[model samples]
Target: MRIGLLTEGGYPYARGEARLWCDRLVRGLGQHEFRLYALSRDREQERAGWVDLPAQVTQVRTAPLWTAEVDGTWYGRRARRRFAQHYGDLAAGLCAGPAGAPGQGGYSPAEADRFRSALYGLAELAREEGGMVAALRSEEAVRALERVCRAPGAPRAAREARVTDLLLVGAHLEQALRPLSLDWYEEGELGSVDLCHAAAGGLAALPGLLARHFHGVPLVVTEYGVPLRAHYLGSADAPPAVRALLAAFHGRLAAEVYRSAAVLTPGNTHVRRWQERCGADRSKVRTVYPGMSAARFAGAGERPGGRAGAAGAGAEPGTLVWVGRIEPSKDLVTLLHAFAAVRQRVPGARLCVAGSAPDPEGAAYLLHCEELAGRLFPGDPPVEFVEMGGPAAPGLADVYARGAVIVLSSVVEGFPVSVVEAMFSGRATVSTDVGAVVEVVGGTGLVVPPRDPRALAEACVALLGDPERRDRLGAAARARAMELFTVEQNVAAFHRIYLEVAGRCPARRIAEADAAAPRPFAVPAELRVAGAGSVEVTR
Candidate 1:
């Protein structure tokens, strides 16, 4: 089967959130022919170029989400009217809010129908007129937004949105809708694929939605981290009006994607809950944990004195290791304070932060953590910051091997991949009780409350003081990882899901010429001729 793998700022791009998992999926399922439809988030990402693709990848189509290009093709008067009608409905739907409540001034069914029609109408216009960037940024777009916000049943927050808020929302919507104008939707492109697999939700799933609408292609959306959650987190500081509009837009899109998807695969239960709230059918949702490569950690269970243990001498007897991208959400400050408390009780304890900062902000945060460590600990049993450089960095398994306990202090988490990696390396863990951390850790690790340094410190100390308990927990952690989080398991789960979804979809009928007909079997004339030539042909 030919699969259309849709992604935004991932796979093919050297750096992005979901690149590694998507690459693994494509390579793991080599039986299917894949065509990548990627959306680049920035100029640097495009300049970085793509990762090496497998031979099974048939083609790749990409569009930039960061750059804006004008589409000058003029729409006839009739087309303009259609655009107004459809665009009006879309804007009105957004303005009325996503929850279909009468008291919330939500749109009625008739109004929602108008929004859907207007949205498709504008999409049709963009298809004919090349693109909608220029039009979407025009004053007409502002007026349209204003008209909807001031509509009879519009939400209070939306009605209060200023001109600037409308422009910002409009600009974002235009870029998100840019996929509609791309030529990838024709019969020769996405329409030809047997399945459409969206790597994440939001704009990445837009093409998949279009494919499902334009053709009868089945869509399977896989979200390791829910995009709507990220949108909500990121918009926390935005103006109320802007937040309201964007939230409504994202909520509606998520609902549509959930409603149309044949199957929804979330990496963990946390994301599954998010999908459920967005109207996904519980029967259609499956939780497939993200897979991790465990080959490097094969010797993790070996004793420190064994030949396979490289960190035999360097690893402190009671040290703790935290491996992840250094960021505020990781709650390094809490971890640092926790370590300080751990030091007073367990004087021999050390904390190794093994990972690089993902961004400038994270780098700064790392610096702050380093400063805090110096002030709090005053040089005894210090907090060691380890930078894992690309290729040259120490393997993650080795990092895990250097510690008796692994720690995760994240305040918010989706599917903590680092925690799974630690588990694969046979390290006992102490993690915050947030997101899917507890679910992934199960009974293998000690759980503590987030943002509470005392609880984190006590948990770490408990693991550090009990060597036998640590060993038992570590063994159980590794067993859990092998049973659930290995790449093979992930691949098998997806393979089954693909088959299940495809089975529900109507089967495609191939013409006689297009089908690979079996070759007719024939008996050799020599065989029929009895002892002709005494038989054997030598190579």
Candidate 2:
């Protein structure tokens, strides 16, 4: 199968959110040919370079989202008029708030139709006009957006947008929607692919959206974290007008993507609920948990002494392990306070926090946690706040091996990856009930409400005090992780999905030919197939 893997801030990049998963997926499915369409988030990421791609990956095309140079493509007067009409409808649709327009929520049939028509109309215009760089950045585009914002019945916030707000929102829209102008839906690109698999929603799904629109390509979207939710959280501090417009635009886009895709796979039930709330069809959505490699932790999990309650297994007595990037969202404050309570119950208990700080904010948060730990446990604190894999801490598997109980205290989470790793290492876990924690834990371990130090401490003390329960839960967690969250299971599920989509929906390879595509396959009259798809008559 020829699969076009669409991504944003991920895969092929050495450092990215979804890079590891994409690399693993491609490597696992060596039978398929892959074409990568990536969007670089910044110059630093581009300079960081990409991971070594497998031989089956035939092409990689990338665009930047960090720069805003003039597109410089001039349009004819007639083309400008067409661009105005299409972009006008798109802008108006974006400005419509849930209260004003029926189609804005995309739940009602009429509203969904309104959203789809305006969206595809703009896509068609971009296709015929070569690119939208000039059109989207033109003064006329700003005027169009301004008119929508000021229009009667528009969102109240949008109607009050200042001139500066309009300009900023216009430029932001151009950057976010830039993928619509990319020349990817041609015979040699997405058109030839048997399936268009988007690695994320929103920006990552844009190319797949075009492919499915222009050609009859089937699309399958996999989202561990819904992009729409992220946008809402990230844009909270922006101007009210900008926030409203962007949110409405993204909401409509997500709904359309879900409706158009043949299948929607959310990493956990947590993500599935978010998508459903954003208007995704319940029948089309499936929950597929992210997969992890178990081999790296085999030494910790398979050791004879590693049996749950076994004395002298590598586990240090009364130690609690915490592993993940050190950030405020992890709520280390709550963890520290909870540990203080745990010490009262089990005086000899020790806490080990082992994870690197990925940014300055996280580094600052880590320092704050250290200070808080000191205040809680003064000199020779029972809490050992460590960063990176060094003498103070150690590698993740080593951290898990050193603890009888792994704890995740995050108030905000996606899939609780650290807990999964602990499970793979055959360790009992006490994690807060947030995001996918409950779904991932699946009755395998203890769960407590987030941000409750007393509750969290109590749960930890119970597991720590009972070695037999720890042993039982650890063994069960290890078994569950092996069965549901392993790479083998993930790959197998996607393999079946690909075959199902391809078997039912044939590739739209021929439609690109109607556009006078440059590929030899589009012009059989000028070339004769000599052998193995090679053209002998081409000049």
Candidate 3:
């Protein structure tokens, strides 16, 4: 079968979140033909270029979501009216609120219908005309936005939205709708695909939706981290009006996508719950965990600390490893505070934070952590901070193999790939209670309350004090990882799911043809048989 593999800022990019998993999927499912539809996040990502794709991947098409290039073709007189009506409804719906609420600024069924109609109408318009960038930035666009924001039943926040706010929201919407103008839905491209597998929602899934609309293809949506959720989380600092408008738009889009999809695949139960809350059909929702490559950890799991002593022979036995990107969300500050508590009891205990900062803020945070660690410890193990950059530390397996215990202090997470990797390495883990961490650990590690340094310290001490218990937990973790989280198992599950979806869906072109074909009304007299006094029908 031909598959349209859709992604945003991932897969084919050298540095991306889902690149490795997607590469593995394509390589493993060699029998299926794949056409990649990727949305590049930035110029840097485009410069990084694609990873070496396998022969199974038949074609690749990409567009940028990070920057908007103006396609300045104005709609004709009649098309302008259509744009006004549809774009007005879309802005109005966003200005009101999400569905199922009944009050001022809340959505109604009529409004929802209006939004859907308007959205697709605009998409159709974009397909006919060049693009909507110039139009979306027009005075008419701002006026429509103003009308919605100042509508009678508008949200208090939205009503306060300034011209600047309207412009920003309008600009974003313009870029997002650019996908509507893409010529990918032509017969030779996405139209020929048997299935459209969107890697995530928002702009990434736009092509998939178009494919389903233009062709009769089925769409499968997978969300490891819900884009709507990320938008909500990241927009905390934005002005209330901006946040409200963006949130409402994304919420409506998510609902529409979920409603239209043949199936919804979330990486964990946490994400599945979010999808369900967003109006995804329970029957269509499936939790498919992201698979980790376990080959690197095979020796580590099998030997179980044989290399631990070799690397840190003179160092303390109670060394804890925290490995991941050095971001504030990881709650490294809490981890450092927890380590101070751990040191109060076990003075020789060491904490090795092994990972590099991804951004300048993270780099500054790392420096702050170092300063805090020095102030807390005053001398001793010196808070070993290893930035795994060059040939010095080639990969994560070496990092995991050198430590007696692995720690996760994140206050928020989705599936916690680091925790799973630690499990694959057969390391005893101590993780805070957060998104899917407990579910991933599953009694194979110690769980603590998030953002609580005291509890985190206590858990670490408990794991560190008992070698036998650590070994037992590590063994259990490795067993669990092997049983549930291997790349082979994940791919096999998806393969089955793909077949199941295909079985349920009508064959696109063939079924359409069959539906349109005329049926024979009667059988030939020679082929007919007599039953009692009546003539029987025969094929």
Candidate 4:
């Protein structure tokens, strides 16, 4: 099978979960040929360089999401009219509320069809016109949007949008809808592949949507994190008008993707709920958990001279370890407060925070955490920050191995890799009851509510004190991870799904194949009947 794997700031990148999972799939499923279609998030991501490709990877195609559309500065009168007609319907659709979203009822099936027609019409216009940038940025585009926002059927929120909001929306729509102008659906591109598998939703899934639209190709959208939700979360920084317009645009796009995709694979039940809320058909949605490399932590996971699985490979007796990228969402402040409580309970307790701040905000958060540690225990701070994936433990297993209890204090999370890594290391976990933590832990470890320092402290203290119980839970955790979350299991699940999806669409594909002149002996002797139908085969 040929798979067109679509991604954004993921797969084939030097870093990130999407890259890792894609690499694993390409490598593990050697029977299938993979063509990576990746979208670089920014200049830095493009400059970071791609990971080494596996033997099964046939080709890699990349486009820059951060780059401006290469617009040819001209549009004739007919072209202007075409753009207006298509853009008007698109603008009107964006002004309406998506089904199940808060607004004037929901976009009815008729409205949905109208939206789809408008979206595809614009896509066709973009292809015919060479690009969308010129028309999308035209003054008429803003006027069209303004008219739609104030229309009778427009959402109250959209109608409240000012001129600045209309301009912002028009600009954003130009960028986000740039996929409609791409030639990825042309011959020998994504259309040639047997399956179009989107590694994420939103922009990453756009190409897949187009491939399915143009070629009748089956699309499998795999979302480990809901990009629409991410957009909504980050939009809080924008003004109300800007936020409302972007929200409506993204919501409408998500519904279109969900409605058209052959299958939607949400990495966890946590993400699955988001997809469901975005109007994904429940029957077409599958919960396929993200796969992690258990081999990375196999050394620490080995049960040695123990009654049960202990964090035996250089495990410290009373230390709590938190491993991940240092970010505000991780709620390290709560972790610090919890550790302060742990210190009072266990006099000799210690903490080793192993992770890096991935961004400027996170770097600041890391420094703030250090300062908080100083204030919490000025005289002799037991909380030490160690650089994880160090030369001594390059695999990151040493970070998990060094702890009696693996702690996670994230208030916002999505199928946390740190918890799974700890489980693979046979280390008991104490994580906040957020996102997929409870689902991943599966009764193998303790889960406390987010922002509750006392609950976090109790969970961590329980694991640190009761070595026997920790050992049992650690064993159970490792077992569960192996059974459900290993790379092998993930690949196998997707492999089956790909076959299932493609199997259902074979007739359509076959119908599209060229029925050229038939060879004289095309029919076998045994199979050839004397009067099998009219017998006027194509010549």
Candidate 5:
């Protein structure tokens, strides 16, 4: 099978989300040919280069989302009229209302159709007239948005949009719609693929949506984190009117993608809920847990002394381990306070925070956490913040092995990867009930409410005091991780999904001649079977 794998700001980039899993998926399914369509987030990511490609990956096409230069596509009078109609409808979709609202969610069937029609209409125009980069950034585009905002029956937020708001929203729309102008929809390119598997939602799914529209290719969308939710969370500081428009735009786009996809694979039930809330059909949504390698931690998990056995000779029985990217969302301050309570309950309890500060904001947060820990514990603080992969914190399995109780104190999270890793390492965990923590934990470990130091501390103390309970929980967690979160299971699920989707939506035949076109079952089963002495096959 020929699969077009779509991603945004990820694999095969050296840095980004879903890179490792994507690499694993492609490598695992070497029987099928893959063509990669990746969108680079910025110049730095592009400069960082990509991971090594396997032989099965036939081609790779990438575009930068950071830059939108003038493409010099001069539209004539007829093209201008076409652009106006499509752009008007698109802007109107944005100015409608919030997504998933009671009645005015902005994604009624008529409204969603209008949004999708306008999007594909623009894509067709771009294909016919080269590109829409120049037109999307033109004064006419801003005027169209302004007109839509002021139109009768428009939402109050839309009506309240200033000229500056219109311009800002318009610029953002250009970036989001930039995928429409890509030259990847040619018959020999995206159109030739049997299946378009989008690695994420939002912009990453845009190309797959286009391919399914332009070519008869089937689309399968898998989302670990819903992009619409991320957009809403990230755009909180934007102007009210701008925020409203962006929300509606993304909402309508998500609804359309869900409606069009042959299958929707969400990483967890938490993500599935978000997709359903955005109008995804329950019948189409399937929760596929992210695949993780367990081989590295299997040896540690099988040790006799349980958690302490893997922690080496210097292992601390009461140590609490926290591993992840250090950010405000992690709420390390709450973890520090919780540790203070744990120390009161179980004296000499140590806390180890091992993760990297990805940005300046995270670095500042880390510093704040260190100071808070000092204030809580005073001199010779039992709390230690170690940079992941540094001298203090060597590797993931090693870090997991050092502590009896793995702790997750995040106020906001998606698919809690650290918890899964801890589970794989046969360590009991205490996590806050946020995102997919409950779903991932699945009664295998203890979970407390987010931002509650007392509850978190109590959970930790219970696990630390009862070695037998900790061992039982750790064994159960390892079993659950082995059953549900391994690479083999993940790869197998996708492989099955591929066949199911292909069976339902037949691949587009490449040529008029049967000899040139790829067939689903080209070779007869009887002929392919071993030890069948030249068996006659009937079609």
Candidate 6:
């Protein structure tokens, strides 16, 4: 089987979970060939270069989503008319109110069809012409957007859109729709792949949608975090009109992607619910947990009853561990206050905050946390901050081994990777009830409500005081992690899913003999299992 793996931002290039998981997926499924279709987030990511490719990776193609290049494809009179009509319909769809005032970002079937038709129509136009680069950013496009925004039945926020708002929305749409202009849909490229598995939804899945549109390829969309939810969370500061327009656009796009995909693989029930709310078919949705390696935590898991200080991993009997990226969303300040309460009860209790700051905002938040810790615990603060990879920073295994209990204080989280890691390391955990924290912990650890220092501190104190309970939870967590979240399980689930999707789709091969035909796969053949015999590449 040949797979066209689609991704955006962190993968192959950027050093993060995206890169790790994708690399693991390809390496684990060595029997299948992979073709990477990556969209880089910025120059920094592209400059970072790619990881070593395995022999099974037949090809790699990357494009930039951060910058737009003018392809100078001037449209003639007829082309200009086609562009205006399609662009008008698309903009109008964005401005239309949801059925029965279902509120912003809500799906209305009639308008969904309009948006879907206009999107593919624009894609078809881009294919006919060289690209939609200039036209998408043209004065005419802005005018079309403004015209739709002012139309009779447009949403109130959209109707209030100013000229500046139109330009901002238009510029964003141009970058997003740039995928439609890519030359990857040709017969010998994506058309030839047996399956197209998107590493994410939203922009990452756009190419796969085009492949399904142009050829008969099947698409599988996997989302660890729903992109629409991210957009809503991140766009809080944008102007009302701009926010409304973008939200509706993303919501409609997600709906169309869900409607078209052969399968939807969400990393947890949290993400699965988001997909369903946005119009995903429940029958087509599968929950596949992200895979992690237990080898690094093997020694830690084996010594669940061992004291961290005894092993020189840097923790006392009452030390609590917090591990993850340093950001405002992590709610570290609350963790500090919680620790203060824990210290009052346990007397010798301490907290160790260990993680890296991915951005400047996070760095500032880390400083605030440090100051808060100083104020709360005064001289010789028991709260320690350790940057990942620093000289004093503990190794991954040591990080868990050092703590009597692992703590997660995030007000917002998605598939809490650290919780799984802690579980693999055989450590009892205390995580806030956010995102997939409760789902991932699977009753193996204590969970508290977010923003409640009292609850968080109580949970930590309980675990610290009861060594037997901690050991039991730790052992159970390790068992659960091994059974459900290991690399072998993740890879096997996907392998089976791949075969199931392939079996359900029509069996055909894109024959080179009729390469010029509009429908590339004009030939048919019987579908065979991967090892049974030679199987033709058909989506």
List clashing residue pairs in candidate 2: 103-111, 308-471
What TM-score against the true fold does each predicted structure earn? 0.90, 0.91, 0.90, 0.91, 0.93, 0.93
Stretches of candidate 4 exceeding 4 Å from the true structure: 98-106, 304-308, 389-395, 507-539
The worst-scoring run of ten residues by lDDT in candidate 1 lies at 519-528
Candidate 6 error regions (>4 Å): 100-105, 303-315, 390-392, 512-539
What local distance difference test score does each model get? 0.80, 0.83, 0.81, 0.82, 0.87, 0.86
* Two-way lDDT contest, 3 vs 6, winner: 6
| Candidate 3 total steric clashes | 0
Worst 10 residues of 6 by lDDT: 306-315
Q: Write the per-residue lDDT of candidate 6 for residues 360-438, one digit (tens) a residue.
A: 9999999999988989988888988988977776798887888889999999999999999888888889999999988
Residue range 314-380, candidate 2, lDDT tens digits: 8999999899999988998999999999999899999999899978999899889988888899888
lDDT ranking, high to low: 5, 6, 2, 4, 3, 1
What range of 10 consecutive residues in model 2 has the weakest lDDT sum? 518-527
Residue clash pairs of candidate 5: none
- Candidate 1 residue pairs that clash: 86-118, 89-115
Question: With candidate 5 superimposed using the best TM-score fit, by how many Å does residue 455's alpha carbon deviate from the native?
Answer: 0.7
lDDT per residue (tens digit) for residues 168-220 in model 5: 99899899889989999997789878889999999999999999889878899
Candidate 3 error regions (>4 Å): 98-107, 304-316, 510-539
Winning model by lDDT: 5
Question: Model 1: how far is 207 from its true place, Å?
Answer: 0.1
Predicted structure 2, TM vs. truth: 0.91
